[model samples]
Target: MTLYHFGNCVALVYVPYYLAYKHSGLSEYGAFWKCVQAGMIYMFTQLIKMMVLATFFPDNVEEFGSYLIGDFFKYTVDIADLVGLHFVLDGIPGKGHSKVLTAGIGWATAEVILSRALLLWVGARGAEFDWIYIQKCLESNILLVQHIATATLIWLRSRHNLNNNLKTVVTILLVLSCYKSLLFESLIHILKLGTWLGLVVKGAFTLAYGLFSLSIYAGMAELMGIY
Candidate 1:
């Protein structure tokens, strides 16, 4: 039954992605190759981010201020993800919507494979069942929402026709999206929240961010007259 368990976990992890690609008109756009390209860029960007973190933010930090400094620099490195997303957006050949969808899905999928798949493969298939694997699957879904919203915000930020005020709002939201996990980590540490509570907070924040991004997108289109 371990295999069956594994299958269920896999389905929970991947089915949303498949439905998103199929139902969001990415299938009609034939964006598979573009998604692949974006995934490749994601991998490369992560590799560079890791290298930078390792080289600059070595783990010997002991002082509280050092920890703060280290974390600050590390978060700065995460901004590279936006640079990578921009590359993915510019590199893909399609309209804005297709490019955003392809880049976001591809980036999120690559993240799941690289970060979570092996843990599930080993843990979910083990004889002892763990709710952690299921939790991980739910986290994967959250990541999808966050990535897609961030992608839309980034695309919106790129539009020169968007007024400075809207662009500034998008930029602030984009930064918040990018630093989401760090903010959550800080909150969890400060409040000493349990794992389940932390997950609940993350889910709520992601939902709010997604809705806010959609609202901004609608406002942007209405104002600029183009996506």
Candidate 2:
């Protein structure tokens, strides 16, 4: 679950950065470097998510399921925890934890707005913002979204036709369906290993999954001509 969460985070951050860099008219190597920087920014964001989760919702962490709402809440809490941890970990008396708590609140507000904006981008053609509809859309379309976004960005960069929307959509759905049924399901069950491995195995798998997901996006980008 953690791995899946991490992978999604990496894809979210890296894909955008890659697109931005590609569009910026940067050389291939330069764009790759910029993407690397973006990955670092994403790592910082993930750290923020972890810190916030640890500080605020420490007790409810395990209960948080692997869904869009869960991701939103987790990331929001992470941002908050980053702020609070900065001050509290510094050991500056009462001012220590104060900063983090204050930061967490601010982070939550910002993220809520940003999340809405992202959803709008993803569901721009749709008319209402029903949570249930959005959830269904996410479950059904996330893989497609990832592939199309990556492919489109690359194709545009390479001055390609960008006329393969149908193919991209179909491919994503098929891949995600298989992924959910096989790999994702198996990975979820593997979480049981946490007991014997002291949770470190789970954390490692989460990170690896995140990286692998990012690579998939990268592959899509390359195939679509963005890379």
Best of the candidates, TM-score: 1
* Ten residues in sequence with the least summed lDDT for candidate 1: 61-70
Count clashing residue pairs in model 1: 0
Which ranges of candidate 1 are over 4 A from the true structure? 63-66, 224-227
lDDT of 1 by residue, 1-227 (tens): 89998999999999999999999999998888888888899999999998988887778655426675656667878888999998889887767678788989989999988888899888999999888888899999999999988888888888888789888988888777666777899899999998889999999999998998888888877776656
Q: What 10-residue stretch in candidate 2 is worst by lDDT? A: 92-101
Q: Residue by residue across 1-227, what tens digits does model 2's lDDT show?
A: 33444345335434543453345344333334333333344346656666666676645434666454454454444333233323322322222112222222223223333444455444533443334433333332232233223322222222333347644643454334223324443555666433334233434544444344445545655666544
Candidate 2 global lDDT:
0.38
Q: Where does model 2 exceed 4 Å of error? A: 1-32, 55-227
* TM-score, every prediction: 0.93, 0.24
RMSD of each: 1.7, 19.7
RMSD of 1: 1.7
| Candidate 1 lDDT score at position 66 | 69
